[model samples]
Target: MSVPVEVIFKRPEALRDRPTHYCPGCPHGIAHRLVAEALDDLGLRERAVGVAPVGCSVLAYNYFNCDFQEAAHGRAPALATGIKRGRPDTIVFTYQGDGDLASIGMAEIIHAANRGEKITVVFINNAIYGMTGGQMAPTTLVGQKTTTSPYGRDPEQIGWPIRMAELLSTLVAPVYVTRQALYTPQLVRKARKALHTAFRLQAEGKGFTFVELLSSCPTGWGMTPVEALEWGKEKMMAYFPLGEFKKPEAEEGGKK
Candidate 1:
């Protein structure tokens, strides 16, 4: 008899079988894989709906095996709110970048979280805008150089980088809020756990949940993938430390 080998790795059924458009070493691919794995593990692939806004992952619909909708720039949260409300049985989520979530979509995200919409949000904070150009974003670290900030970001004029996880945690409605990263294998594992928690919260009808993943944009940052990951661990992690900012009570399946 021939010995059989166990399949240790394979694409999640929730993710479409297609090559991603993300540049080499971009963390978006990791983020997508985590989301797909969560959907598969949670048995939500059949009903999960994703909302993708204008950004690097704007083509998200083409990648997810589940249904996906495109939202206007900075408006993914609002769109997700509507979808979740109209189809409460469906698992709804929004994948947004720093430029779309923290900048133009600031108010939309704030209100949606405040309202406790039954939705999950996957926020990718790469610090600099990656789609349109390498421009300064609301989450850009101070002294970080970008196309619009050739001299590095000036706090005196641009203000400090917005801490979305901390900001959203201050609100009363969100069931869970966390900041994670994908720079290392260890961090990537934690990020996947956070993603799973956010989705699990929504599956249980626990109000709004948000997980911010600190990602690297090698092309935008003008560095190799390895260099970007190193920079992220040294600088970005200093500003956006990874941890759960908030969670429901332990009795309610959240961290104490």
Candidate 2:
């Protein structure tokens, strides 16, 4: 008998044919897959609009099959808020990097959360800034060396890495917040589920939803793809714990 092929290997309809621009071993590709899968799961492909930020994954518009908009550096949240409010019927999502979200766009993100913008935010926290070379990002861990911090990040000089999920959870307006990783098959599955929940909240007209994905930048981290995966589990996971920080209420008032 011939071996049967599984349907799991097929690409999602929400993914376009354009070859990915991410560097070999870069986790951006994985993140894209998770987002596409979420859209597919929620049947939101046609009505979904994605905002791409100015970073290494700036060209995310090319990979996702849904409508896409380019936002100015660190302004994705503001742009996404406008898009979501203007087209309340559609599902709006913003893809941002650590540098874009935790740095220059910090105010926008916090205020959007405060207002409970009904949009989904896919935050890719890869520690270092990948687009303009491997510089220290706001999420870079202490003792982690980047181009801008050859001596490693110091809490006294640079302060500690920002925990976006925790910070967003403090805001009362957000309906959902979670941190997930894409380093392994199990973790990837969890990340997909988290992404799906975020989009679901958007579809339900719930408040803001944020999913911080701990990803790797192999080229920037100066490690091979395999090494980077190991490093993410050993180093990144310690700082950014993976779990749901908040969730929508149940019909009876309990946590959903």
Candidate 3:
């Protein structure tokens, strides 16, 4: 008799039952799924420890099945540092949004990269703040309007969106840095690969892997999910070009 094949299309063992608390069309859920899938693919679900930040994903602990620690606003890297230092055997990672990572946590994120912490950071950049009533985030586009930037982001007052992947790549300590978007089917597949690569780098004990995902916030952006995805491709991608910023071998010979 021929052996039978089984197919499965269910939640990963590393994810929990609580449906995501994200608004409709928010890409946070997709990002969460990608992270969970990466953990499963690396066989590190049980050994993974996630540090949830204070933003849209603040309650990420309730969504992921692995052990989690809730960090204060902009303190996820600091907390993850402690966790990784204490339990070097555990695969530590942090999930943070643009407001949390590029704004209040900028120093922490930079220092962590400078120190070459053996951890992975998944950064969701949706342009504007998704939580707290759609305020302007550090990654908000120059022409984007939020509650705080009702008249659109004025470059005179507010600077341009921070290119996080490029900024981190300037540091020599990190081993991997990449920027990917999830606005289209092909981009989504690319994002999955980037997430998987980050997890793989962590598994290999490579230093400081960072993946910045260009996500969408439809509700906050005052558009349908489909429209927001289109905007990301037409506008967001122009400013934040996708691709790996830094890799281990590239830096080995002093090349960026």
Q: What's the TM-score of every candidate structure?
A: 0.97, 0.95, 0.94
Q: For candidate 2, what is the TM-score?
A: 0.95
Instruction: List candidate 2 segments past 4 Å from native.
Output: 1-8, 251-256
Model 3, span 117-144: residue lDDT tens: 9999999999887779789999899979
Tens digit of per-residue lDDT, candidate 2, span 95-152: 9999999999999999988999999999999999999999999999999999999998
Model 3 residue 23 lDDT?
87
Q: Give me the candidate number with maximum lDDT.
A: 1
- Misplaced by over 4 Å in model 1 are 1-3, 251-256
Considering every candidate listed, which one attains the maximal TM-score? 1
Model 1 Cα shift for residue 89 (angstroms): 0.1
Pairs of residues at least 3 apart in sequence or in different chains that clash in candidate 2: none
User: Best to worst by lDDT, what's the order?
Assistant: 1, 2, 3
The true-versus-predicted C-alpha distance at residue 121 of model 1, in Å, is 0.4
Candidate 1 C-alpha lDDT tens digits along 20-119: 9999999998999999999999999999999998999999999999999999999999889888889899999999999999999999999999999999
**Alpha carbon lDDT of each predicted model:** 0.93, 0.92, 0.91
